[model samples]
Target: MGVLDQLRKEADQKKLSEQETVDQQALRAKLYKTQVLPKMQQIFKYLQELAEHLNYLEVPVQVENYSDRFPRLGTLMQKDYKINTDGYGGFSDFNKLVQINLTFYCIGKGELEYNVQTKSAIEQENAFLHAKRVASKMYRLGGAGREESAKFVVTKKIPVRVRFEVDYEQSQIKVMVNNHTDFSTYTEVWQPADIDDAFLDTLARYLLRKDSEFVSLDITDEDRNELRKKLQSIKHKEEQERLRGVTEQKNSGLEKKEKLGDKMKSFITGKINR
Candidate 1:
């Protein structure tokens, strides 16, 4: 090939590559502006409303915007926010508070990743132990040997996790419980536009309910039986106390009546003597 023809071809290729890069940049900017930013704002607003509901229920909750974590690109870096139940002032009844992390990958095709976490290592360990116990029980009931059960069924860690992904393509929220590979899965989808205050309130309550279940995973069958016995004992004591109170009232009333009769009799005797 001629030198001039080769030089021309190289120049054309360079120009085409630069144009493609520019086009890709423009597409990303448009996606962020139109879809990503709007969706992020909507979710933030929803979470803020949810926090209000939680506060009304006297649950310590805080919603934080974490833009400083990823600082770059136009108006916002990434839609990274966290809603955490603060365990302070002895307010949290549960041993562990739920921490929800919602992050939107805006640089890509706006996918929202939802993760639930807790800081209580003890609770996690207890849950793992309880899982093993339950697994062993099930294996025994199924006529499987204890050694086989221990080897096959018992996992090292029972990390209590609930994950959901906002699928924009299908307009559905794919929810995975405990582990992704588990058959226990469901979809909880809400249109971005349709998410209102009522929805947020329900979502907050649902999250709380799930969190409580996760925390209570440590309670085994033995613990439940013990609790049942204690409750029965308490009821029996209460019944005894009620009966005692009634007896005391009746005895006091009879004593007062007898004293009144004695006074009347003494007055009558004194009058007759006079």
Candidate 2:
């Protein structure tokens, strides 16, 4: 091939690569706007509702939204609860911490990801442990220990980190909780329509139970069932109100048509009389 022809070929390939990058970014941005943003908002609402539902349980919950930070990414963070047990073993007190972060990103094929990190530590009266425990016992049971049961310890006060990734294009959800001690992963493939408020609420419950080892958040199963019923009732009421508003609009339109007809009839009568 001639030098000029080679140069031309290289330029064309470079242009094509740049265009591909632009196309990928544009597609990701569109997915972020339509799918990711709505899901993130729904997740925030779910967490807020869950927090309110668990209020009677006196669970210390904090939910925050960072949706305005687009281009960079948006996040909904929930710090579920914190508790420290009475001092034991001379000077060490067991502690539990649960934090779940749902973050949105417009990247690659487009995705929404959530990372949940739990820190269960043994704090000496006035100091933190140097080698903080990576609470792996949460997943040690339920056949998860087949990975490394020896390395996974079950006592309270150890820290753990688990990540959940949602792939919008693939319609899949993946979970992984790995540390220096143990490594475990789970995948749940779902229909596109299944990713909604109800599903997210269920996920919230699952993550909390998994990380906290179902520690009584001072809430019983009955209490959780009641919360579900309350949420359903609120949704039904909202649907009723929406239908009522639509009916009112239809009635208003009918009234306007009647008034216009009456005006026309009066004009015709006057014209015929004249």
Candidate 3:
């Protein structure tokens, strides 16, 4: 080939490569907007509702993130391309993926904390109760360990799954401890400034007649213990009634035997007199 022709071909190829890159970005953005954005919007609603229950005022949905629409799959030739293209210059089925993560900030009064308390047992109990409450809430919501399905036939409001990510921030406080020594002990208190806890715990119980996961989020220690106590009481009463029923049957049999003996004694007495 002539040198001039070779140069022209090389130039054409470069332009085509650059244009292909733009096309890919465009298409990725387009699908992201049309298909992905709607799901994201629903997820945001779920998060917002969660925050609202926690009484978080000014829980911003961060609308600015959605401003940049997903562009149409970037392209050069304006011909339609399928989702699966070879790595060199093709499409991918998993192309338009945008990850959304949740972050909670406490801009409220009286935050929560975790620490070595004076009553270790009480602290342990609190932790245990909280975990149970969370689970029971999930169950009532029809999310109890994947055993059963939960649904609302009327409204069809499904809560989005929010992945749990624990983030801790604390504010330190200094307390003076006086012992028998000349020098006083300095204790630094670390308290939680914010907590993204299950806010729907109480609400869940109010509505849940059963442990269905399709309900609300508020589950607490008192509620759980109350339930346990009730079940125990019911079981005990049922056992007592069952035992009482057996005793009654035995007594009735004994009384019937005694009556039969009396009848035979009276018949023998009459026969002798006759």
**Stretches of candidate 3 exceeding 4 Å from the true structure:** 56-101, 104-274
Alpha-carbon TM-score of each model against the true structure: 0.32, 0.36, 0.25
- Candidate 3 lDDT score relative to the true structure: 0.33
Task: Supply the global lDDT for candidate 1.
Answer: 0.40
C-alpha lDDT values of all predictions: 0.40, 0.40, 0.33
- Model 3 — TM-score against the truth? 0.25
Could you give candidate 2's per-residue lDDT for residues 1-274 as a string of tens digits? 9999999999999999999989888886676556554554454456546555554465442222322212222222233332111212121211211122332111122233322222232222112212333222222222443432212222222233343344644433333332211212233333334467656655665544333332123344576566556555655765786777844535778779657755655543333221
Clashing residue pairs in candidate 1 (N, C-alpha, C atoms within 3 angstroms): none
Best by TM-score: 2
Name the TM-score of candidate 1. Answer: 0.32
Model 1 per-residue lDDT tens digits across residues 1-274: 8999999999999999999989877875665445444554454457656546554665532222312322221231222223432312122212221222321121222222222233254345346447523221112212333221111233222122333334533333333343211212323333344445654555445454433322223345576466556555655765786777844535878779656755655543333221
Model 1: lowest-lDDT 10 consecutive positions: 133-142
Q: Which stretches of candidate 1 lie over 4 Å from their true place?
A: 55-274
RMSD of each: 33.2, 23.2, 34.1
Alpha carbon deviation, residue 55, candidate 3 (Å) = 3.7
Worst 10 residues of 2 by lDDT: 89-98
